[model samples]
Target: MTPAIITKDLTKKFGDFTAVNGINFEAARGEIFGFLGPNGSGKTTTIRMMLGLLPPTAGEIQALGISVKGNQAELQQRVGYMSQRFSLYNDLTVQQNLQFYGAAYGLNKVDLKNRIQDALAMAGLEGRENAKTKDLSGGWRQRLALSTAILHRPELIFLDEPTAGVDPISRRAFWDLLYQLVADGVTVFVTTHYMDEAEHCHDLAFIQRGNIIARGSPARIKETMMDGQVLEISTSDAIKTVKVLRAAQKAGKIPLKEVELYGSLVHVVAPNIEKKINDIQAILKKAEIRTEQMAVIEASLEDVFIASMK
Candidate 1:
């Protein structure tokens, strides 16, 4: 089957500045594809071009087996979009918002009614239909917005940082809904900056400064992009541990790839670091920083992401 989305050498520019520069990739049918990047990394610009909202300066795009340029009217009916900003009216009730979007999608009265119920149940907003959209919690409002976007049963959906400000529990709940959609044969193209969320995607493209630095599944990226082994250290003070390790690396006391603080722990990356464990211990011991624990551990996606950026 043809991929759900295809872009070849896609490029977008605003005057002399290039927002998305010659990026290329494909999102497969019925799979979640994550576009991972930091802020100002051209993720939104690329999505707009794929949706035909912004014309690309170069290259071609095909969505759902159809060209996006001249067939926008037909494509709009087959795809859904939930933007970074809220798209629903604050003053409208939950049911009212769904009704409005359904009508905009040209759903007939009979089909609209059934689809509305399905949407309400899917969003867990059946009894809250009469509540004002502004009165809902951030999580509830996000779910409602997602429900509205999918009311017309589009085959493909584009979500732009859908879980940005929501709490962790709510973000997990929202991802559950996305999993359900994929199981029902919907293609999800989501962009997010969260590394943990990127792990949930079937495949991913890591973008930085309008360039794709790496592309693969979480496991593949970690295996291929990570430059060396990771040494996890638990010390009395994480900040002090990082400072000492970095100083040691700069002074030629030990060879290390990267030293960063991870929560309360310190992670040091280097090649064949196991052979230098004693040297690391001796340095920390001299610094009077107690080494509670230290071991070589597997590299995480966040580790690979940070290394790739450097």
Candidate 2:
């Protein structure tokens, strides 16, 4: 089957800086493709290039099996985009906003009416059609924005940090909506900073400093990119434990690849961490830090991503 989106050596530059270096990836139809990256890592730039809103300095992008270059108008009609910021009119009523977007996408009056009703139902705003968009909560606004973006039912949708500021429950709910879209054969390309959200994607690409440092399914990335096993240490002072462990690694006292603090726990990654587990506990104990519990645990997407960033 043809891929929903494809890019080869896709690149973008701004005079002295390259926002996106040569990066290659593909998104299959009816799948959630997560583009993960930190701020200024070219995720947004790449999305803009794919949407044909910004021209790439070099390379090619094929979205929906059509070349994005010189075919933006054609592509625009077939794809929907929800930008990082809210794109709907805050002053408009919920139904009005949906109507405007439906019309903007050239939906006929009859189709618009049906789509408006669907959008209202999808957003759980059936009786709140007359409510001002500005008065809705962040979660409601996010759902409304999504409903509006899909008002025309495009084949593919690009969502840039769609759940950024929403609460965890809302984020989960938004992802539920995405799964529903995929079940209905809509392809989703989303860029996000949430590691949990990344885990939900069918496939993922981690970009940093304009380069794709890692790419694969969540399981594959954890298996391939993690060079060492993770040792989860429940400690009294995670921050200070990390500092001590980092210093030990740097000073050649401990052979650890990464040391990070996860809440009250300290995670240390190293090859054969079990062999050095005793040494780790001894080192922390000598520093007067109590090691409550220690165990080898599975590598998480966050662990792999931080390692990749380094």
Q: Across residues 128-149, which tens digit of lDDT does each residue of candidate 2 receive?
A: 8999999998999999999999
Clashes (N, CA, C under 3 Å) per candidate: 0, 0
The worst-scoring run of ten residues by lDDT in candidate 2 lies at 118-127
TM-score of model 2 relative to the true fold? 0.98
Question: Mind giving the per-residue lDDT tens digits that candidate 1 earns over 6-32?
Answer: 999999999999988899899999999
TM-score of each: 0.98, 0.98
The positional error of residue 308 in candidate 1, measured at the CA in angstroms, is 0.9
RMSD of each: 1.0, 0.9
Off by over 4 Å in 2: none
RMSD versus native structure for model 2 = 0.9
Q: Number of the top candidate by lDDT?
A: 1
